[model samples]
Target chain A: MTPKKVIIADKMNQFSDHWNPRVIGELNGQQVRAVKLKGEFVWHDHDHEDELFLVIKGILKMEFRDRTETIYPGEFIIVPRKTEHRPVADEEVELLLFEPASTVNTGNVVDERTRTTLQKI
Target chain B: MTPKKVIIADKMNQFSDHWNPRVIGELNGQQVRAVKLKGEFVWHDHDHEDELFLVIKGILKMEFRDRTETIYPGEFIIVPRKTEHRPVADEEVELLLFEPASTVNTGNVVDERTRTTLQKI
Candidate 1:
């Protein structure tokens, strides 16, 4: 099958909703996703999956139990499995996420923000 | 362990060599790498691994047996397993690569450019 190149900015413009991630690329049982974030996310941790968050626009505050990391554009943070954390964005932040396909947005928490099924853009 | 955010640009500044990739982050069984590319790469294909190349600076020409795809900054292309391809860059190009940890720089062929052991930066 022929593979196509994905333009991150073009995909980001396809969605504006916060916290919902859209699948853009998939390979090696992992998915590359694009999501927008504003305000705060629930504190949670994945039991078996690690998540990589790459900032595309604005700043992201990744809060762990002990400290919060401010990630700017061109920066990325890998939240290890079983480490409870939260993501906070004072303003809308665009991100590209890399993780296993089984990873849930809300992780271990089944909150209102939990997304079991994601849309592909 | 406290997870640290990796500044891609800062890590990129640490290396200037072409074609050699340095591991920047790893999650699950996958590795995230940063590499600078110029000229042309050998035509090769992984038997079991898919590779993702995201352009960060300059332009990348991904040549397939059938056609060529031009990838720009903020753009990415996935080379599926068993698909012979080559990467050509007229000028220096910065890139982020995601693939399995065991992936070699030259797949299916061993050349002087083959990197069996990759360094982590």
Candidate 2:
């Protein structure tokens, strides 16, 4: 199969809902996803998956037990596995997330915000 | 340990060399790297690893054995394993690469352009 190019901005325009992630590309058992965030997320941790969040638009505030990190556009942060954390956005934020294909959006927490199945863009 | 934010532009400004990639962040046995590319690269293919290339600045022309793909800023392409591909740039291109930690820059070809040991920025 031929590999295709994925335009991140175009993919972001496809979805308007907040907190839902859409898979854009995949490679080597890892998936690249585009997600929109408007408010706050649940505090949780993945037992075996590491999450990388790259801010595409606006800002992202990652709150951990010890500290909170403010990530801006053109910046990224990696949250290691088994570390409790939360992501909060003051305004609408666009992000690209990289993680294992088996990762769930809510990590260990199974709440209304949990997304076990993601749509591919 | 607290996870720190990595500024993509700041890391890009640290190195000026072309074709050499520097590791920026690592997670789940995968490495996120920043590299500068110009001219043409050798045709090579990783036997067991897939590579993802995200264009940060300029444009990248990925030449496959059957077709070619032009990736632009805010766009990305994934080269699957065992696929013969070469990346060419008419001008200088800055990129973010996500791949397995064991992946080599030159894949199966060992030449002067091959980089086995990479520096972390």
Candidate 3:
């Protein structure tokens, strides 16, 4: 395979949709995805996979069952498996997400916000 | 465990050694490490692990057998397993590396620069 670099900022400009993650790269059964977030996401939890959220731009407020954590740009948070959490952003936030291939966006609870098929950007 | 966010910039400030990777986080047997790069790295290839290099600051050039890929800030490149490559940087570059926990920096060729024990930041 030809070695190619994935430019995150260029990928972020390809789409303007919120909460939908675009596949950027994959390795070791894990995938690196980019997502644009605004407003609030559904309260959910991945029972079998852990999710790593890296804020590329803007601030991200992750609300959990007990407390809320503010993730700034250049910061990352690892949401353990089976931990119910919600991600909220006041403005458009660009982020990179890392998780296994079988991980579902909405976790066990399937909703309209769940993205079953992710597009590669 | 208290949920804590890993700030990439803050972690980058904790060390100044070049080519030595410091563990930042781990998930599913894979580790997220931060490395400061300058000059050129040795030509090596991991036999069983694929390495992902995300340029957090400055520029990185990965030289392969056939080509050289330029990875800029906010860009990432995945060096496939068994692919002989060397990373070169003109100046100090901050990068985030993702790979299996057992992955060695020197790949198949063991040298004095090879670090057996990695420090956690």
Candidate 4:
């Protein structure tokens, strides 16, 4: 691929929907995606891949079956494979996520929020 | 792992030095590291894996053998494996890097700017 810069904010503005992610780049067989989030997300887990959350704007509250954590801008969290979790936000949030190309944002479960058209940036 | 926040600013403050990266998390055997950069970095490349550079703040200009691109705070770039490149910044910039845990920041070529102890955040 050509040597190019992936302008994040510019990429984010290309789409106006929430939950649906836009694929920005990939390396080592893994994909990097950016998504806009709101309210709460479905609780689920990927049986074979971990989920990485890099908060870009606003605050993200990701909760597991027992405990929960808040991820702010410049902060990141890794939800290992097979670990169930739900991501929530009291307000709107923007984020960058890293995981296998096939990973469903909603994990093993499916819902209206489980989007698959996330194109590579 | 417990559900907890990885406050990047707090983590960044934990270290007062420069060049060295702090590992915040990892998934699927790849590590996620954060580093502060200014001026320029040694020209180098990893022979085995691609290099990912995500600009968190300020601007990043990466020059390759043929072309160069500017990556801003919301942008990212992936330098394919074995692609020689140099990172330059007119001012200080904060960034996040994703590569194999064993991949050195300076690629295969070592220099004074290379850092080895980037601990896990």
What TM-score does model 2 achieve against the real structure?
Answer: 0.98
Question: Which of the CAPRI classes, incorrect, acceptable, medium or high, describes model 2?
Answer: high
lDDT of 1 at B77: 95
> Which regions of candidate 2 deviate over 4 angstroms?
none
lDDT of 1 by residue, A1-121 (tens): 6688999999999988999999999999999999999999999999999999999999999999999999999999999999999999999999999999999999999988899999998
Model 3 chain B is weakest, by summed lDDT over 10 consecutive residues, at B1-10
How far in Å is the alpha carbon of A39 misplaced in model 2? 0.5
**TM-score: model 3, chain A:** 0.96
lDDT at residue B56 of model 1 (Cα atoms): 93
Chain A accuracy as TM-score for every candidate: 0.98, 0.97, 0.96, 0.94
Best by DockQ: 1
The per-residue C-alpha lDDT of model 1 at residue B104 equals 94
Ranking by DockQ: 1, 2, 3, 4
> Clashing pairs in model 2?
none
Write down the lDDT that model 3 would get: 0.91
Tens-digit lDDT track of model 1 for B1-121: 7699999999999989999999999999999999999999999999999999999999999999889999999999989999999999999999999999989989999998999889999
Writing each residue's lDDT as its tens digit, candidate 2 over B1-121 gives 8799999999999999999999999998999999999999999999999999999999999999889999999999999999999999999999999999999999999999999999999
Residue-wise lDDT of candidate 4 within B86-121, one digit each (tens)?
Answer: 899888888888887878888888888777766775
User: Cα lDDT of all candidates, in order?
Assistant: 0.96, 0.96, 0.91, 0.83
For residue A111, what is the lDDT in candidate 3?
Answer: 81
* Chain A, model 1: TM: 0.98
